[model samples]
Target: MRVFGMGSKAWLLNCAILFACPIAAQAAQDNGHGKNASHAAAGAHVHQISNHTTLASGAKVSHALHTASGKRVATRSFGISCVPYARQVSGIQVAGNAWQWWDNASGQYARGDRPETGSVLNFRANGHMHLGHVAVVTKVINSREVIVDHANWQSGGGVSHGVAVVDVSEANNWSAVRVELGREGTFGSVYPTYGFIYNRPDTGVVLASVSRPAPQPSINPVPSDLRPLAERPWRTMEEVAESPSTPRHTIDLGINAGVSR
Candidate 1:
């Protein structure tokens, strides 16, 4: 993985496009492309967890870019898109065990990187966890709290949205975060159909997220329910990756912990 400093020219461009376009519209145009599939595949093959570096209460996390051929890809810190998952680009399988962390092909999330406001949010599945496409981070409340809107986080296929405020006082454990259920749905109906968030690298460790139960799927689908509030035209990856406000950074994290070969 190639590490870099946060806040680069690319980051600025990313921010501009990310905020300018509507989330729903973007997803609609680029729903479930080869990129997401590649990341999902890479996530399926990674092994081991808990080896990445950490921060001291909101320390900036670093990021890197790796090519599909096990080559280091050039990236500007948080500016790189976690949207579609890393494996999607590398054609690698994301490694994970029953109820474990979804390790990207290059172990993307755990790497110390700067977090963005709307990047893809990740969670650990304690054990025997087998659900896919779970939730989205609707809002970020300071460095300690976040709001999650999910559809099928639970088994019943219920959809619900709630807020989770991270607990900084207690080892940054999400046990203190607040979770509230609002509605119900089946699978990714009310949740993410295919979206990414601008996430800060330290979000998972520093701000413990509160995990809540997803709502039960309704017998009948809600009409006009899943339509995203905003819609926009689709753009090429180059276009998408070249907007302002992308948050650039110099690659600097030390890659001591290697992914299982």
Candidate 2:
């Protein structure tokens, strides 16, 4: 295994894990319709492809998880109550498919090789880069619990949720995961701006154990986009708890009133 961040280099000798280093964009091509002959390690299991929103601020976002005909991909992210932002980053584009794949640097399918602790689960679009997220596989508990740590997750970075742990199973082909939203360590906010975990393969699981700093005052002014939500009535502790359903995915839960399915 190759490491990128934090100056530690340790190899997990069991399998050779090859990743597209630097996490940059690859050449573009039409999404996969052909069977990759060599790198058939089992394509990734996709969950759903629908969009998600922020719970607190009522912000809406979307990702590259759309179809060639421009349909919102179906995904289990919202259905299972697990945040889909990270999944979107991991290249699970179409919402309901649950099993898709993209090519790696060696021009093979993502799952062509066994994934490492901090591999960037990617989705391919016609041989080019379409979408993906940064995820650190935190655990491998009997195929029942494969905890992944990731942040800056949004439906295409539409809304931001902090890094979080999810329960995955191979039995379902890893298509669906049980997500733990608002689990404390997933996200961080600093006044008008926020920061989430980005693609950091060099520092995969090693950084998973690292804790985020407290939200600090930003040296820069807050962006104007957030002013309306930020200035909205501040909810008391009880008001917030009472209306918990109102803040799903940071979008005004009410925002989806007529729009939600």
Candidate 3:
């Protein structure tokens, strides 16, 4: 009803506009929520991409087309040990096994649990990794994510670069890490780390040196046992010799008799 005697049609029209405005606004708000949900999904996809580091050409070939079948991806590089590779690339200058690099850098370089670019990430030895491992950090994406260059992680002393290392430790410390392998954006192994060895922290990404000699494993070649020693027992030299029966044939003891032609 109109209070000021306004026309019925006009009053109805005014009421319709008032109610329609809120309804339209609510519909727009609902559409906005839908748009926000789509944006959130896209953001999640981008974050997943960020988890993967750049893949090397060889690694790409090795890991490309891999599936969740739990199959192995073989690296092309013949053999590259982590120690020398870390030394040359990161310039840490430490020698010996990768596990030892942490302690080896004790007085020589600064060491810490945080990730740093160009620092040597020292992995602790475990049941699977007897000698441990070392890798040169090329980029620190965040506290828990980084890209690394190392040798012999997969291949026999084969070098791999631009691999992702994610800190999985409960304390947010880099005590444990999962390595992105085969350049396929797949993480194969989770390793325990001692820490990062900081020397030339500012050094940027360095390519793998495929020309460097791979770690040569010592080989002792022994001649094959040609004889079946079990079948033919050999006598020791200590057995005493028996002299000729003194001469039941002594007639034959004469030198001339022994020399009978």
Candidate 4:
């Protein structure tokens, strides 16, 4: 796998990219900003969601990035959505919106009202979640409860890891569930689900497609006075803003988390 690069860089990002690209494409499709409209039109569903990450005050700095050219550019990249994250991570090999995952997995993957580790919990399309949502089950706490890791769930494209999900279905089925909104003890509204799509990671197309370049990032000039500092002739406003104690690295990125690692 050429995409398998070396070093601490591969620590978290190497594996994350294999699944992140498709996820970003799904986002590009929904936002109608990219070339996936016709392809996305193949289905009406697949819904959307986000996570929590309060960007720096006064500017959305969370997704901002500085290119290698030292141009001090700004790229507004929202983090990964749930669909591609669930698909590639769970190896479900299904495409479309998050809501359509259940039907998409009809003959391809095993699904049911029960939760299982590594399974994709497919949420139904409802008034609240128009495109629907999908999450990768991380741990099954019990027959009626589980922990899931998913992106774009709370706010800022932040991935919520080991979040508790309680089954709220009347029949004790996992047809409906409420996710932990933030800190423990605070849960959100009841969400209908089509159940869990269970399967092992398919190393076929989904994994192979890690070779695809990350989604194109939206570029903007980093606001600066264009005055180079005496000590550091290349210093930009953002570079100056970063903590002086923080190590510096020039990272040119397109949508996959902005930071290299």
TM-score versus the correct structure, for each prediction: 0.28, 0.24, 0.48, 0.47
List per-prediction Cα lDDT, in the order shown. 0.33, 0.30, 0.60, 0.58
Question: Cα lDDT for residue 21, model 1?
Answer: 81
**Model 3 steric clash pairs:** 79-156, 79-157, 79-158, 80-157, 80-158, 247-250
Q: In model 2, which regions exceed 4 Å deviation?
A: 1-101, 104-115, 122-132, 154-170, 184-261
lDDT of 1 by residue, 24-91 (tens): 67786687676766655543332211111133433432212224644321211112223223333322
The model with the greater lDDT, 1 or 3, is: 3
Worst 10 residues of 3 by lDDT: 217-226
lDDT of 3 by residue, 42-71 (tens): 433321222223332222222121225533
Off by over 4 Å in 3: 1-79, 200-261
TM-score, model 2 to reference: 0.24
Deviation in Å, model 2, residue 190 alpha carbon: 29
Ranking by lDDT: 3, 4, 1, 2
Candidate 1 yields a Cα-based lDDT of 0.33
Question: What C-alpha lDDT, on a 0 to 100 scale, does residue 127 get in candidate 3?
Answer: 63
Between 2 and 3, whose lDDT is larger?
A: 3
